[model samples]
Target: MLSKEELLQYSRHIILPEIDIEGQEAIKDSHVLIIGLGGLGSPAALYLVAAGVGELTVVDDDLVESSNLQRQIIHRIETIGSPKTESAKASLESLSPTIKVNLLTQKASPEVLNKLDSERFTLVLDCTDNFTSRFLINEWSVSNQIPLVSATAVAFSAQLAVFNQKLQHACYQCLYSNMNLPEGNCADQGILSPVVGTMGTLQATEALKIILGLNKADTSFLLTYDSLDTAFQRFNIMKDPSCSVCS
Candidate 1:
């Protein structure tokens, strides 16, 4: 049952045939854990909060720097020196006071992953730009049987994927069997502002679809986008029987 305020707040969603009041309620009861507060995480967090996700946990240890202001729109110029987790929480809370926000102002470690109450969260979003954190989140989510939405963007390209243990879906390791690719981040390689925003928005949309039970097919695939050519490509992925993390 939606309160008067909730009903009004999610009126747009309530009217959608796919996401009626029941779907809106599911979103309001769901929890998402975001592993980074950078470009991809920024828009994903903002949209999730706006869509009425009940609880959000942001994990990041970095501080807002001048260079991050272009795409990390969640943090403002005034928050340049503040911790990323704190800045993201403050901005999200201001956007939707009804949503509960949690801040983990520390780097995510195996210890932190082991301590998390996976049952309390419906999904995990891997917005981390590094391969190490990406693999860590994938391993933990696979072991805990939690669905994960992963996105990464650099320069003009981005990738999005959804991994779920319940469906025997492919994990990150399944796609990138080895992490031998050259390491490059936004700090080293400049990124177009809208590139990250587009990827993050898609990540949020996928998360919402999973939460609302609006998606009936397995979304266990990879979506690639190139802003320069405005081309979107999707590659089908399957769980690798020899996957080191999920197998």
Candidate 2:
């Protein structure tokens, strides 16, 4: 049950017919894990916390740098040189004191990821940039039967996808069976600031929908955005018959 303060705090959300009191309550009962505190993870973390997710675990071993302020909105000029996880925890908790923000100030190593499996997280956001991190996170999500919201941004383009093993959808690997595409490293390839933000906010939107048991896709679908045209495209992702992760 929500306290009077909470009910008042989330009055805006409760007013939405799609997300009424029960949906707000479900949001309070859902726990989410977000990997990376970069451009994509920043907005996702901020919104999820502000929306009152039951618990949020953030993983990032990087430190806040001046370069990050261009896109990673969760960190501040004062937080420069501090661990990203610490910076994120401080910012998120300040947004919603009732929500617990767990910090993993270490790398997203297999051991660390495995320990999280016991938590039975309701969903995961893969905001990491590289295919290696995405592949690893996808494998973990598939094995744990947890849905994953993955996003990537390079230059002015971004892609968003959700993979839910419980729904038997195609895993992330099915989208990119090879690492031949342009990598998502913003340092290597320049990016427009809002490009990543658009996808990150979408990731948070899809996650909340899943938590509220609304419009959860039964099959995998990928959403792509082009800032130049201000266009959004959706494509189906079929599960590869030989997919090693979610075959």
Candidate 3:
């Protein structure tokens, strides 16, 4: 039921056998919530918006800083003092005027997530940098049975994974224990600009695949990438029976 403009706009996607008109429709019907606007969230948001997702709700409390420009591709020099959420919304809408971009200019909280979940978010993308927010988002996704795509990039390395309540797989909390955690973020640890971009791009791909019903298998593996070595690694994610969130 695409308009002539939509059909022509998404012609490349509709032409592909993997994502024909039906898949494009599903893409347009999906509502994705992204919880960050930094390195990982930047490219993920751009690709998802360009891919014609029906609606996007982006959450970020930070303002644009000069240092962020190197990795945060969604913001510009003129927006350096702007809130990340407002800046990202303006940028995304500029890309696709028809796409809906909701802005939450504050850190996520249980109450806020509950309100959004009630409105029926199709899925969530955990693009946050800190473990606190990741864990919080993971718990919400798990409890609500919404699938989550989580990604991280720091110090030339990045990680990506999908966690779903419907699958018999490890939730983010199962793998990310307090004792075993990533040390620092790009601010102190240092990261190549494109390395974070790569991770964010991959995050969007997985999210789109899930929304299109193309990912039939449980994609719970911990996928890691090292920009320096140009290497990729995947490790199995075994569900911890004692996982408080998923158990």
Candidate 4:
């Protein structure tokens, strides 16, 4: 049951016909693990907290640098020296004290992956920029039977997908069978601020849908967007029977 404060805070969601009180309650009871606190993770974390996800675990080892201020809205100039996880935790707590925030001050590693208790999280959000971390997350999600919402953005382009072994949806590896990392990093490629924000927000939306069971109709679809042309595209993704990670 939500407290009077929660009910008041989430009145907008409760009033929505698509997401009634029950959906809002599911969001309030969901636990999300967000990997990375950079471009894509920033907006996703903010929206997830604002949408009343009960628990959030933010994993990032980097500290706030002056260069990241333009795209990482969660970190301010004053927080330049502070840890990214600390800044995100403060932001989320300030936005909604009712929500619980966990800060993992280290980069997520295969060792760290081993330490994760799969049962604790309802879903994992892969906001990491690199392919190594992305692949690791995909493999971990498949092995643990956890659902993962992955998003990536660079140079006005973005992609979003949901992978769940339990649901038998297409895993991330199914989309890219081979590991070929993006050539330039966001730091080098120069990402448009709104591009990352849009992708991250969409990722949060997908995560919420997964938690609320609204994704039952369509489980394996890839959504891509190009901010330059304002074009959005969706493609049906199939699970690779020979996938090394999930198969």
Candidate 5:
């Protein structure tokens, strides 16, 4: 049952026909795991907390840096040199004190991933900046029959997708089988801050929709955003028969 304060806090969500009290309650019961606290993970974590996710487990090993302030909106300038998960916890707790936040100041090692699977997290948000982490998360999601919201942004472009083995959808490996793609990042190739912000925000929106069962079938499609052209492209993604994870 939603308390009076919770009802007021999520009143807007409760009013929606698709996400009335039932969906809002579902959001409160869902447990989401977010791996990464950098550019893409920052806003994703913030919105997920504000939207009333019941329990959130955030994992990141990096420390806050001055350069990250440009796009990592969850950390403060005064938090520089602190662990990102701790900084993010402060930001998220301040936004919604009722939600439970578990912080892990370590890499997404296999042991950690296995533990998360055992705990039966409702879903995973893959906000890491590297291909290795993305592939590993996708493989785990597929193996565990869990849903994964994955996104990537570079320069002025970003792409997002939801993968679920249960849905028979395309996994991240289907999109990028070769993890050896030329290495590039915001530090070296340069990224428009809002580019990652756009993808991160989309990741949060998709997570909420997944939890609420809103437009759930659209998980088969990939949404691409081109800030340079101010356009969004949507296309259906078929599960690759050769996909090592999904197939």
Candidate 6:
């Protein structure tokens, strides 16, 4: 049950027919895990908290740096040198005191992933900047039957996809089987601030939709966005028969 304050706090969400009181309640009861506190995780965490996800666990081994503030909106000048997970925790708690934000100020090592599997999370958001982390997350999500929302951004382009093992949707490896693909490293190349923010927000939207069981009718697709052109494109994502992760 939501408190009177919470009802008023989420008035806009409750007013929506697609996300009425029941949906709002479901959101409030959901637990989410967010990996990486960089550009993508920043907006993803903020929106999920604002949407009333009851518990959120954020994992990031990096620290706040001057370079990151350009896209990582969840941190501030005052938080420089502080662990990203701690900084994100402070920002999220300030947004919704009722929401629980857990911080793991360590790397997403295999051991860490194993520990996370012991708990039940409604879904996971993979906002890491590397393909290795993305691959590891995909493997774990597939093995544990958890839904995963993954996003990547570089320069002016961004891509978003969701992999739900429970639904038998295409896994990450199934979509991008080649590990030799170019890394869209913001540090190496460059990234438009809004490009990552836009993708991360959509990641949060997809997560909520999945939790509300509102994604059953939507066909599997990968969404690509170009900030320069302000264009969005969708490509069908099908599971690979020989996919090592989900096959």
Tell how far residue 222 is off in model 1, in angstroms. 0.1
Q: What TM-score, computed on C-alpha atoms, does each candidate reach? A: 0.97, 0.96, 0.96, 0.96, 0.95, 0.96
Error of 6 at 118 (Å): 4.9
- In the range 111-200, model 5's lDDT, one tens digit per residue, is 888876445588899999888888888888888877889898888888898876667678888877854575787888889999999899
Number of colliding residue pairs in each model: 0, 0, 0, 0, 0, 0
List model 1 lDDT by residue over 1-247, tens digit each. Answer: 6899999999999999999999999999999999999999999999999999999989999999999999998999999999999899889989988789988888999998898899999999999998889889999999999988999988989888887666778888988985466579888888999999999999999999889876566648889998899999988788788988888
Q: Please, what are the lDDT tens digits per residue for candidate 4 over residues 83-191?
A: 9999888888889887898888998999998898888899899999888899899989888888999999888888888776778778998898864555776878889
**For model 2, what is the error of residue 181's alpha carbon versus the real structure, in angstroms, after optimal superposition?**
3.1
Worst 10 residues of 6 by lDDT: 213-222
* lDDT tens digits, residue span 200-223, model 6: 999999999988988773445789
User: Candidate 1 lDDT (Cα, whole model)?
Assistant: 0.90
RMSD of each: 1.2, 1.2, 1.3, 1.3, 1.5, 1.3
Model 3 weakest 10-residue run by lDDT = 111-120
Per-model CA lDDT versus the true structure: 0.90, 0.89, 0.88, 0.88, 0.88, 0.89
Angstrom error at residue 42, model 1: 0.4
Pairs that collide in candidate 4 are: none
The digit string of per-residue lDDT tens for model 2 on 203-235 reads: 999999889878557788999999999999999
* Tens digits of lDDT, candidate 3, 54-171: 8999999999999999989999999999999998988999999989988898898887787775346888999998898899999998888888899998887889988866665679
What ranges in model 6 sit over 4 Å off? 178-180, 217-219
- Candidate 1: regions farther than 4 A off: none
